[model samples]
Target: MDPLPFLLQPPVFYPIIPYACTIFGGLRPGRMILIQGSAGISATRFQIDFQCGCSTRPRSDIAFHFNPRFSSSDAHVICNTLRKDHWLDELKFSGAPLKKGETFVLLFLFLPDKVKVSIGGHHFLDFTYRLPLKDVDAVGLYGDVTIKELSFLSSNPLKSGSADLQKTPLSKTFPMGLSECQVIAVRGLVTANPDELTLQLKSSDSIPFKLTANFQDQTLSYNSFISQSWGQPQNVQTPFFLFYPERFFEILLLPEAGLFKLAINGTPVNDYRPLVFDLKSIEELQITGSAGLFVVQC
Candidate 1:
């Protein structure tokens, strides 16, 4: 039910920051401006949260009114309901001009866990949390905000490919110490239909793997996904999130025998990719971005 945990996981790329490049673009409550009434919302509860902010704002809270007729104190500000203060340690900002125009860059970073921010070379803040990827939310911008360039540096670097394994096939290189491994590449515009998917991989290793959705017990369901060793499933914030061989691999749904197909970097995979014998659901098959960066899709 809660998206906080999934949101906390570290992302290979920074989430979107609204109006990242414009004359007046920054984190605002809503597109216009969020105001608090006498007895309803208050500035403390509402905010113009950057990528990250400390516990308090002194000079002027990021939230402001857009009516152009009201003072900041009298106006309402939207606030983040999510709790991530402990994970975020430093905040940074830059008013530098854009690369080719009059735009500006407003950058913020949540240190410790991961880095989620943008700006020029000044480099104001450092993320403090350890693998804090789930706490990120949509960027908000209100009155008079402009940003040109946005960049972020993560404290923890994500690993991709078998670079660690010297690009060795999972089945061949991984011996006894190896637990299990599976890689797949699937392509085609995703739809609600189960028959529209095909998957393939290259692995002679007999390791058992499962194909599933990003979220658990919802969206797409299948009866073919089989688990090699259930073991003690780790406790994740998301519902039905089960652990697989890869540390980053979090499966929620499974694919049926005929509904989904497989391949490996464009090559036809017959025995390398695992086959499904049971039913499992796939809310979504993540194959790009941070989740996709590690997974090759064709």
Candidate 2:
């Protein structure tokens, strides 16, 4: 039997400059491949490829190539496809989201329309699937850099049957809050035996608000950790059960007029005051722990 999507062994971390990993059973819709590493300070270029196979005595079939080149004064990303040893017209993007010597998170999120790439939690580029995604299997990386981590997992998780949607328990970072009166929503199915689920609007300095769910008591708690201190945990007991395993649900967070209003499955739950002031300080939206999250939108 094939390995579970989340349980697939991560590719061996490569300290050297070049490496490759076989992506068994191919890619699928609503899947993501995460690559974490740092580019060399003196490096000029690096490339990652989704290929048909890794055989290249003559040349292999490269389904998609994402390459970043920094040649002294010029920096850009090159995208193309290779078939039967012939290269197609190059599509060059003008921005390089990563610096030469900085650690970065590179996410390739596969949705139905396109494969969206993000750098440092910001959307960078989009490439349409010119062919069936399942036609590509292996992932190869080469050029001047070190690979800290590499893994592939499902992006959209199902209820009951797909508890192991993420191998090491999913911890995802998303963007949030365009203005003071902002709304954030998450659509997901909770795990059957979830010990904890934590969602936070955070920044490098402080967390404006945090939502914590403890399944053992079927209780929802809200708190804030600011200025090197943990605030009081206010239990929310309204609108009955806000969490139910084996069921699809929607949760929304709306911030306005010095209060944060929360709703579950489109039902009004409660409103609470801010524990930490200055909502503009919150720049990151993060979800961590054993929750089968499907969609998170701001």
Candidate 3:
């Protein structure tokens, strides 16, 4: 038998928090979800849950409960599964990645054994499965959050034990390819007068490739920390990065032998030496500020 085809669902635009949206056909063994939003200035804690239903009085079972608490010095993310009428042992991760007043990209990649949570584009951590995914009929959000976008789309089969990056012809991998550049592309909207958009590739807690787009000063920088101390920042002029709010754009990055070439739309943009030579260690990609996420393809 063949794998299930990718399913595309209409995204929910800017919605009020404490929201719950139904999963059209529940969920499959392999499903991908994108939640785009920012932490409110007064946000100290927030919770996102994948539950069997939206019942209240007689609380329904929750497949995955993601709670991020920033009220204490030791901020942590608590993950748990609610079965029957009791909650399971909580998995708490210290050092929360979310800023109280900054925008973030939360990507949830569901696999057979775990649900991979990527903050921005970089991998955050993985939560082992406790409840059957097929029972998850709703995605709910509550607490101090300003949701910008929330949607689901299925495409490409994931390789076992990692985020899926199908190695095929560029044409087949990306439909919007201008000239068959087998690189990573990010298409999204921009905010006004932003600082920078950063993407970090990390293994465990170590970052290999750190790509930063500075909009306030019109500069692009690349830095790496494959070992211990951070490397010197490689900066270049990118006056084209400045833009008004909600403008559509695409950024393409091709990692050649020694250099990583970047482009805006179809035009050339910038280039820098790749700090990360070992590709397998980069498990996460982090994208923050300056831009909204359309897609992150590797």
lDDT winner: 2
Weakest ten-residue segment in model 1 by summed lDDT: 30-39
Clashes of 3: 8
Total residue pair clashes for candidate 1: 66
Q: What TM-score goes with each of the models?
A: 0.26, 0.51, 0.53
Ranking by TM-score: 3, 2, 1
- TM-score between candidate 2 and the true structure: 0.51
Task: Encode model 1's per-residue lDDT on 79-159: one tens digit a residue.
Answer: 222333332223322332222212223334443343333333233333333322333333343333232212221111122
Q: By lDDT, is 1 or 3 better?
A: 3
- Per-model C-alpha lDDT, please? 0.26, 0.71, 0.68
Positional deviation of 69 in candidate 1, in angstroms?
19
Q: Identify the runs in model 1 with alpha carbons over 4 angstroms from their true place.
A: 1-48, 51-95, 99-107, 112-138, 143-200, 203-254, 261-298
Q: What does candidate 2's lDDT look like per residue over 1-298, in tens digits?
A: 3325223333344446567667867777777786778888998989999888788787678878999888777568898888888888888888677778888778888777678887776778888766567778888899987887575555423223554443324344444434665667776656667777778877778777788877778788888878878788888766455665544456788888677888765467667776666666667777876566655667
Model 2, residue 16: displacement in angstroms?
3.6
* Top of the candidates by TM-score: 3
Q: What lDDT would candidate 3 get against the real structure?
A: 0.68
Distance (Å) between predicted and true CA of 231, model 3? 56
